[model samples]
Target: MAKIEPANGLKSAESRKSLRGTTESLALTDGEGNPFGSDSELNAYTSERQTDKYGFIGGAQQYSEHSAENIPPEVLRQREAKWLDMLNNWDKWMAKRHKKMKLRCQKGIPPSLRGRVWLYLSGGKVKREQHKGKFEELDSQAGDPKWVDVIERDLHRQFPFHEMFVARGGHGQQDLYRVLKAYTLHRPEEGYCQAQAPIAAVLLMHMPAEDAFWGLVQICEKYLPGYYSAGLEAIQLDGEILFALLKRVSPLAHRHLKKHKMDPILYMTEWFMCAFSRTLPWVSVLRVWDMFLCEGVKIIFRVGLVLLKCMLGSQDKLKTCQGQYETMELLKTIDTRYMQEGFLVREILELPVSERDIEKEHLASVRRWKETRGELHCKSLPRMHGAKAIMAAEPPSRQDLRQNPTIIVESPLATKSNGEDKERKKTKEEKNGKKNSSPTPVAAYLEPSEPSPLLKDTALLGSNQSLSSTEHDTYL
Candidate 1:
């Protein structure tokens, strides 16, 4: 302003200063581009730097808009329900398939399912309660003297050689003792039998003590008739039945055995008697029990068939001298869990008759056999008594071996010397023809010498000689 001398740059020094102040003021603009009155004043306004024209927030906004326009809540609910139903139906289908497979398949039960399956099929649940109550009731009544003694005797003998269960104070032995004792108290009639130990041991695989006790009761009552009978008649009948089945399933092996005069009874008795304890692994035995509960007694036959079938293929490998040994070896070697489902199904599907019919026949046959034995007993009663009375009434004779005091030689050396002296005396007597006794020669007195060349040459000559040789040609 001092005449604002239209200075060189169109403004004087004062004008330039004013212009810079104006530009500075313009830099501090509000929303409407207005400058503040004071430089020290605080600004409280917010600025919108940049924004979309639509309410959408760029890429996210487009997706949000598309979803809001297209999706329905009811459709989502329907889809969720559809998937849930599919899962539920699939579970049901799987359950049914598993149950059927359990029944008809021959493979061993899955380890996870074994305990529950055994409990269900073996009537463990029902029998446990049944026997618990019944056993307590029977315990109050006096049991037969013979049965109590028998039970007591067998308690010590049960699983005598099984070291796993034989550790003095272990759980296995304790459980066994408890079950056997409980069963004895419960079933006064059957008491404790030798076979019960193996059966109990088997039951203990999948069950607690009380359940195993009841399972043993069920096995004794339903599956094995006459198993605990005094004379063991049922064991014989079962043997016969098992042999018959073996014959049907393996005729060639049967013929070979028959030709060799071998008895299946020799080895299979333990299998039939103990329910595969001696013949199968404990796990495999448990598997057999799994099928046994559902299929009844016939499972034994089927299992025996499978064993015999397995053995049939391998019979040629066995030496003829090992007939009984081979039969036992075969039983011991057979996989009890082989095609287990198929085996169970085949047996259940094709039993000789209804179980009820078999039960009836078995019982009737047992009764008849008992009656026949009773008749034989009655016929022989007088002779048995006469023999006993004759022995009792006769005066004590010199031949009364029991009355004669046994000479006890304290030392083994003395006993041996006495035996040698007696043998030498007997030999002298025999030479003198005092009696026609063949005395045992003194082994130590006999001198050792080289094997005779004459004997070796005679053996060789005998081998070389033809059957047509002269009658007088003695090789030695």
Candidate 2:
């Protein structure tokens, strides 16, 4: 392959001169075999300043050298070498370099390599190839009109600060609209959700429209099935699952939240729905995504647990919060330093979470969620969580999940005591009428309020059937 470098004096003046007029009509011609004409005269490519007819001296400024920050050049070279090897033999890499893949992903994928790596990790490339030209077919027709308007309104809201999506009808915005619309066409039952906008927008930043579309599909269908579905039932189920884990790991915080009638939905909806896109700092968001795409939803749960523990696990911090609303507000807006790219990446890797741990909890919590669906309702759980609460649907069958098996990474910290003995001791004390004298302050879960406006729109919430189909294929 010929290296395409600008006229930067790397070649001798003689060579540059010889390459000018000597160039042939190598380009494909028109129907008449006539070469396309250029209005500008074929001038010698030069680094020397040129004088125009008016005798004004002119020359282009030398281009500046750009490089990624914080990443050493040697490290980048090593990464490139590894990436090239993986690219050449992806199957071999997947079989023999699986550990390396996880390690490199944890170290943070090079920005230049992120798109290709993400496609490989998420199997987006396969999905894209499978549905080749499907995007164009979908693009030829308008999507559901209801979602069209909503997607249009939300386009400007996604990554507006980034150059790609900043301008109206810019490449970024156009591609975003096309991708989201195609999704609605592909899965009308889900239509457009507020959360999918940011997710798709982020993917577009990394890959081309077709690849980004498949990446989005992989995320919606494989990584986090049912997350963007009507009513966000998947998120609701995950939210309860998160709480169940929280109770085991951070009992004090769980008890405090229960006492104050603070629901996980109040703070966790964005974290789950958007995969922490709008919530985490931009740099941290990218790093989280690298792991999330490679490891699946377990990364989301791990990061979520870490964030919650840092935010609310401290007894002293919880003591200062005057009420549930203030605590929720505090939880919503965390310190920027904690979410900084380097620090957050370090924490995510150091956090004692493993895929095996998440799987076990996911299964049990899902079952518990189904059993407790009648007990939990939309009334007290904030409406911002989306759609309405409903009875848990039947879990995905085992056969459906055979294609995407969860990788089990064991962690010593995975198994934590749920404080069952403490619960028994407290209950025994209560039976002995010692509840009032118990040292720990008791905070009980609150009664339900009347159904909110969110639940009233159940008709528009649609069904989770589309999500269930994909969810079974990925994480059942």
Candidate 3:
């Protein structure tokens, strides 16, 4: 098959001339994606050099730590301490104490530990170990003529203000190029997509090329499969699912979307495909990523829904949006307050966007797509993650879910030890001076009056009504 041209706008004439090959391997004093801090060295060639505390150049040096991130040194130490323990016993946490691990992720991974935890959470560490020497081998190769030029062309465009990619050809761009090229070599069929550049660039900021390569692998293959594909059928499917979910989650927003014929892809593609790296502030990007790695794509859905609700929920808020283009503009440029790491993460979890809901929506969307647009155009449905996304069963069923979907999100604080509950009960008994031999369980399993429509050929989220719209994808 003839390979596709560069998705990012790059001069075709220059693209024919090969960019620098990966003959020179990168060797750094530091290892791993976890940049304990910013990894930028002032670009010697550029006079416009000013690095923010969060690490972007040419902008006033700034600090916009998430609310959760801005804590007393003591509190930071406490979080670090807990994370250290969790890191030490990661396997146990993944299997036994996963809820605790998830709760911790929702709070935020310490910036220092972010890279390491991401490697662990995304199973990137395991992938690297399993495929040892693979990335380095691919990195050292000349790379495919098809993707190499285009990859090189887009390198400077990614995170241009960030010190990493500021220079025309620096370690950041070089590493980003190598990672993208290697992926082209690794998955030659999917080839290169422009969106992968920013995603790869984001990974390169924290980890080395090889580690970043594997992390990108997990994202494309596991977290959001086929998102960066040549056709981007997967992201398109998700857009449909997101829109369908919106109907239940936010009727007004859904109606406004339907009224203006706003496609989910118009708003959701960049947000979900880039994983909100483009739309959100850097700190919030990392915060969202922290949960994304831990809990899988549900975080993205919750975030999209939250944004949709905020954007068009109220009659007054709806008044501001007059048309599709205006709505698209609003979505593309999210409000700064909504992008706060502390605020966004809390609000994301506060809304209930469970895996089951996503799956049911996925099945319904797929059925509709098959009916309307035909099969996903040479694509099989992407695999959805189980409760343990890092290591999961294929297409996890409703039976595999830990809890049923509910409106209110259960706070991690509410997840207390039975010993604490027992202690409270004992105190109450002492005060009453009489103890019932047995106390009723706070939560009783109530059998549903009717069986589920799990396998029914109908719109499950609705009363067997077929979903109408097919959402549209391939975000940059």
RMSD of each: 46.1, 28.2, 18.7
What C-alpha lDDT values do all the predictions have? 0.45, 0.58, 0.65
The segments of candidate 1 whose C-alpha lies over 4 angstroms from its true place after superposition are 1-113, 130-164, 312-315, 322-476
Per-candidate TM equals 0.47, 0.63, 0.72
Report the lDDT of model 1 for residue 89.
Answer: 37
Local accuracy of candidate 3 as per-residue lDDT tens digits, 307-422: 88877888997777899767866775557676676778778988877889999988898898788767766364355462375565432223322222211222233334434686
Best by TM-score: 3
What is the model-wide C-alpha lDDT for candidate 2? 0.58
Off by over 4 Å in 3: 1-49, 58-62, 65-69, 380-387, 393-476
Estimate, for each residue in 1-476, the C-alpha lDDT of model 2 and write its tens digit. Answer: 11212221113232222222111123212454222222121122112434332121221111112211267777876786666456545655565667777787888876556776677677666665556679889888977888898788767656543545545576778989999999989887667766787789878766667767887877777777766664445566677677777777677777777788766665676677778876665557778898888766767877777777777788887877768778866776676566766767777777766656666766776567668654322122211110001001112222321232111222222212224445777888889887635333232211111111221222211111111111111110
Ranking by TM-score: 3, 2, 1
- Lowest summed lDDT across 10 adjacent residues in model 1 is found at 378-387
Winning model by lDDT: 3
Model 3 score (lDDT): 0.65
Give the Cα RMSD of candidate 3.
18.7
Better of 2 and 3 by TM-score: 3
Cα error, residue 472 of model 2, in Å, equals: 34
